[model samples]
Target: MTAGRPEPVDRQLPSDEARELLALTRDLVDREVRPRSAEDEAAARFPREVFRTLGRAGLLSLPYAGEYGGGDQPYEVYLQVLEELANGWLAVGLGVSVHTLSCHALAGFGSEEQKRRWLPGMLGGEQLGAYCLSEPQSGSDAASLRTRADLDGEQYVVSGTKAWITHGGRADFYSTMARTGDEGARGISCLLVPAGSEGLSAAPPERKMGMWSSPTAQMHFDGVRVDRERLVGGEGQGFRIALAALDSGRLGIAACAIGVAQAALDLAVEYAGTRQQFGRPIADFQGLSFLLADMATRIEAGRALYLAAARRRDAGRAFTKEAAMAKLFCTDTAMRVATDAVQVLGGYGYTRDYPAERFMREAKVLQIVEGTNQIQRLVIGRHLTGR
Candidate 1:
């Protein structure tokens, strides 16, 4: 653990390898990620080299098969790794999550030849990826996307815009969804488009209040030609593939939320213990102590909820509902815990000197991304009512 930060909770690992992986993650975070996080975030600088360092360490591809250059770790272990990274820096952690999500369509639906040709390079960490599903007009209503991919002999001419794309301009490749046939979900298809393709361009990154170190931009495909071989899965299968990937991605978001909450709670507790009031530590007061207790409880609960969802996924169980519930609860908990943390630090927390205010800002986005809390509740409700 970094100096003055709370000790990480003792995690139960299934094997010695998992334990070793956690140790390595902690060392890397303390040495590289945590130290530079505040500086990079404040300047809104994307730390591409840090991502490269993580790639070199095989930390970027933990959940996929080892044969294709992934770590071959289970979801449970992979999520815990994400938690540690998020605790260090939300931008890096969420960037990793988005990259993993971008790879899902190709890894899970591509033919063997396609996987052999592309998966190796992607999972090897030499290249970065972005998922292009949301458009300017479509957010939660993903099936209403208007991006077109007209068939042209052995290629697809893609034209449209993808909004709120993480690593939009910097990614080497994009896993993009486009309308291929009639309107609605059935018309969609997935394609892999390289960054240097002619007619493909990215708009300036969005100006955001938090997670500034992660670039989010809009990508435009103006008659970009993609080879037919780049098509992932069959035509009309893109929506299903996208949904499947989201089930897993939701768990990733949940883990990241818990990590943020834990970090906020740690900061609050450390400050409470050291900052004196009326010649006594503020932590000695019953009012502030109760607040800290509630924050800790919420963090613990959020962690358990995400871990349970991850375990279900690893067990090959249907975890869509569980994933949604986890995403909703954990993100909401993070928002609350981070807000409370800001309160715990009083005036100092509101200033940029401490990270409490930053944490609060970062926590708000988690509730909105990867399918908002409202969408998650809709998913869970549908599952319960079979509607």
Candidate 2:
């Protein structure tokens, strides 16, 4: 859900250079992503080369530090890049977002040495990463995650299962959440686990309704061993780290939702103007025209919401409520806009021959992922109440 209220008047907007990058990102999506997304969707294949292209363009690391092979770009700029990718192809957008989320534990709380060891690979395409926090029983209630990690001399043996893991089998690295001390949120800890670690395995991907191109699997850590140095933060600091990572991650989802909405809108608008009924373009009709207007309005508004939150994050301001609002608003709007886009296309939109049906399916997942819209409401509700 990427929609949020309008930005304050004094807040700085995208700078000249940032605007250029945004244009370039959107251009790349139109040139590369839009043309290829359909095939990727039909084949249910991951476009690993898309990462190579993005890495070569320095787009993958747009939000990270330049010293670590990243662009060190502002969040405002980086989110625009995300918005563009998502607009053309959600799988790539989600892949980028998950990679960024994985990078968070290392960037925010990891020791300098740890960052040096890991950040470069994550920023580049040489290494792919996943964030493991959601469990089968604990999606909205992340505090109930039961993965366990027990110390065994200098090494720790981590054992548990993480559900709904993006890039689960394909990722080279996993930023995992585990229980290391007690019960509830305070007991959790974050660990950086390499894919090749012994006893670490993944179940075959879950049958998902949308985003079929991006793999989702249940990862099992049966006595998976990690070095003491791999600990992301001090003991029992995992939940705090996860929450911080998610605050930013939600903005990514917000941007992705906007992308989904735009994709569906683009299809609907083009189809409305081309496909004829009653001897005229449907775009000529007042009723459908009004729907298109609303769709366009929501897309722009959703973009503004995530951009606003990203700017706040970049400026070191309190933006949790803003991010949650963006996630809540944008994703809901995407679901609605995509659903309506299909209706605008009528029967043709529902067919697999078109992207709208796929977009509709993908939009529903956005509401479920990151944090469900309900969870986002609770976050916003608690913030408003000072809870």
Candidate 3:
């Protein structure tokens, strides 16, 4: 909710540079992001300029190596910046996350020649990206995706549709996964398809419940020809690469979840303090006060959990289970905190004139994106049980 100014967050940054980065992010959010968030979101307008501004600010490339026009900020620092941006506007924050996710396949697994050719532009933020994995029939079971990329002479001819793709129509590039050989995960391959591929097209954006400012659409590959060099990682390695990227991407979603919840909590607290009831502020009532307390607690806990998972990743430890846990807990927390925020505002919260209702709606998609909460539990369970 953009109803009130965000409360200051006490962040634990690793270095002076990181501290400066956070300050710069806050300044940018206050000046550019917060002011237009309400109006732009209301009109379902995507703020491409905002992303360009963030790109120029070196924010869009944080957590990547600096040699390729990246910021090279660690995951811990990068995630906190995401939290701040999301606190201002979820569409922007999540857009940044999806862009980073799109870059992961090449950044982490591409050949040296591939990196030298494409890394600079993608990291520079002038070009946005989309990750294509989930198909209409295979949202949760991504390995079952039916998109095919068959070899034809020196090029691969792709054919199939990718559903629920973020930045689907507008991205400069797409990191697409398709089946190249036998069925299932072993046959999947990752491809870097440029936006203007001959047979590539995007359907009209989906009318989503929230995050309207970020476009989501189904992308069609009608025999789109991609060069052999565009293959990311080895053939039959796409599923492994995709899973690895999700391990990190889930943390991004977790950070964004905390940001939304933090914004909702801030609005709820501010409203409770200023809006009078029963001849005094409703915040004075024990019932409402306890609810606010619980909301704050969950936000703090979710933030810590995500940060913990991020730290594990930064340390090069296995963090898939932790990432799943963070995604599950933090998104659930956002939903609860946003709902509580509306409850605190009472009748005003339900109205579109206020942002509590919007926050509630936005929180819902977090539970579904990346992987659903049910899928997160499955991941965690599999990790624990050695399945």
Q: Candidate 2: how many backbone clashes?
A: 7
For candidate 1, write residues 132-214 as lDDT tens digits. Answer: 99999999999999999999999999999999999999999999999998999999999999999999999999999899999
Which 10 residues in a row give candidate 1 its minimum summed lDDT? 1-10
Q: 1-387 in candidate 2: lDDT tens per residue?
A: 111112211224467777677767777776777788888888888888887787777787788888888887888878767877987799999899998998899988988898898888888757778999998898888989998999999888998899999998989899999999989899999999999999999999988998988999999999999998899999999999999999999999998898789878877888888888899999999999999999989888888888889889999999999999999999999999999999998988789888888999999999988888998999999999999
TM-score, every prediction? 0.98, 0.94, 0.99
Residue 342, candidate 2: Cα error in Å is 0.4
CA shift at 128, candidate 3, in angstroms? 0.4
Q: Tell me the lDDT of candidate 3.
A: 0.93
- Which residue runs does candidate 3 get wrong by more than 4 Å? 4-7
Q: Residue-wise lDDT of candidate 3 within 55-160, one digit each (tens)?
A: 9999889989888788988999999999999999999999999999999999999999999899999999799999999999999989899999999998999999
Candidate 2 residue pairs in backbone clash: 1-326, 1-327, 1-330, 1-331, 2-330, 2-331, 3-330
